[model samples]
Target: MSHSTVSIIAQCKAAGLRRTKALELLIDTLLASPRPMTLAELSEHDNLNTQCDRATVFRLLQRLTDKGIVRRLGLHERAAYFTLLLTGRHQDFLICTDCGKIEAINAQCPVHALEKEIAQKSGFTGLYHELEFFGTCPKCSV
Candidate 1:
């Protein structure tokens, strides 16, 4: 089992939440998915493993988000998708229009230096930022 999976169970237990089979399945599903998953998509996953209700999944996901174990991405005018955050991976999302797919990208962003430069010029400190890019993906465009 992955450390994240173990940590998730520990977090839930620490928070006074029971680690049900449903919750385990939910975690497994999120970990297995290659992209972010909307609540609806999560409820309807073909795996048919999680016996948890949509609301339960939503609440658990929110808890995970609070703990920084998941990142939420708002896709254009629709419900947000939850992406599990793995240790040591800085992540960003790319959403596809036609298929409603979410892709995670991790790159060593040099923009951090640029941000520092801007902060120095502007006399701002203790600052970090969130960056997002939107466009038609190559598969969607084709």
Candidate 2:
């Protein structure tokens, strides 16, 4: 298991969630994935498909999302994408409009400072932001 996965599992335990087989598999899958996964994609994973039903996956995702262990990316596509939310790790994505490919932007997040400033001004705690850029990828443009 990865450090992120272990941390998330610890968080789940702290939140009173049990360490089920399905939950463990789901976390492993999400951590191994290079990008955010859709419900269909997650359900179709070989390990998860055999062990748990689609409904189980959906419910687990919902619970994790509620607990801030997972993040639902509201991209332009009809399907929602989910990714694990590692502590102190933030990322932005570049989404290809034509092919629907999502790539993590390697640059430092420019919005963190702004988010802090806004939070201080508004007296809000635990403020965070999600940023994504939409454009045609080179493959799609060709």
Candidate 3:
């Protein structure tokens, strides 16, 4: 198994969750998705043949979130999406309303520089930030 998968399994185990059918379904669903997915979408995946209830999905999401295997995006007060990323390769996201696409933007991220400036100005250290930009994609513009 891939290191991330192994890590996820280990994390779940450490959190008092067993490596069971539900966990396997959760992992497979997250890996297969190219973009962040909401719990509703994940639970509805046909291929999983998942018998686990919504509560199981929620619990697994929480465990994965704590482990950093998934990054959470709060779209609104009511809904959030969980996206997969390689560890340490964190980047902001741009969600396209038209095509339901997600684009990662990392080049020349001002957030990095801003953090440095903030630290220099405030005499603080060891800080980071999360940034996400949402808009209609190119195809949607036309």
Candidate 4:
């Protein structure tokens, strides 16, 4: 079965979400962005304001997040950022405390074995996890 797909509208339809301008714009923006973005950043997106207002964006983000089409990343105490939950893609983060810069690692759970062991010991089934490492990035470290 072939599995490479790129249409966010199709992806939302498969997820049982109706395609709307706000949803489409948000999905398109998130998919194109390299890093997660805060609400202010999203509101200020070059192409987004012409399509939807800040409130519309906020509501769409909530709905997308609830539908598991998007992910809400609590990067720091200041603001929560948003990213898409695309198929066949996963990333963990390395945040710089000094500069507040973020680096997304392509690694998917470098601790799967450890997670399995912990699950067995704790008698938990269907275990899942979230891992984010915060430290000084190379630029900040130097």
Alpha carbon lDDT of each predicted model: 0.74, 0.88, 0.73, 0.75
Q: Best lDDT goes to which candidate?
A: 2
Model 3 alpha-carbon miss at residue 23, Å? 1.6
Identify the superior model by TM-score, candidate 2 or candidate 4: 2
**lDDT tens per residue, model 1, 1-142:** 6777887778668866678776777788888887778888887886532476788788878887886667888665778898776655566666766666666666666577888899999999855655566778888797
Angstrom error at residue 130, model 1: 4.5
Write candidate 3's Cα lDDT for 1-142 as tens digits.
Answer: 5577777677668867778878877887787777778888887887444578777788878877786566788555546788765555567888765555666784767777778889999998756667888788888998
Worst 10 residues of 2 by lDDT: 71-80
| Predicted candidate 4 versus true structure: per-residue lDDT over 1-142, tens digit per residue | 1132246667678878777877766776777788998888898898698888999889888877887777877645657778877665667777777766766877657787898899999999966665678778889777
Best by TM-score: 2
TM-score of each: 0.67, 0.82, 0.65, 0.71
Indicate the worst ten consecutive residues by lDDT in candidate 4: 1-10
Backbone clashes in model 4, listed as residue pairs: none
Candidate 2 has an lDDT of 0.88
The predictions' CA RMSDs to the true structure, in order, are 4.1, 2.3, 3.8, 4.0
Residue pairs whose backbone atoms clash in candidate 1: none
TM for candidate 1 is 0.67
Order of candidate numbers by TM-score, starting with the best: 2, 4, 1, 3
Better of 3 and 4 by lDDT: 4
Give the poorly placed runs of model 2, Cα more than 4 Å off.
Answer: 1-3, 14-18, 74-77
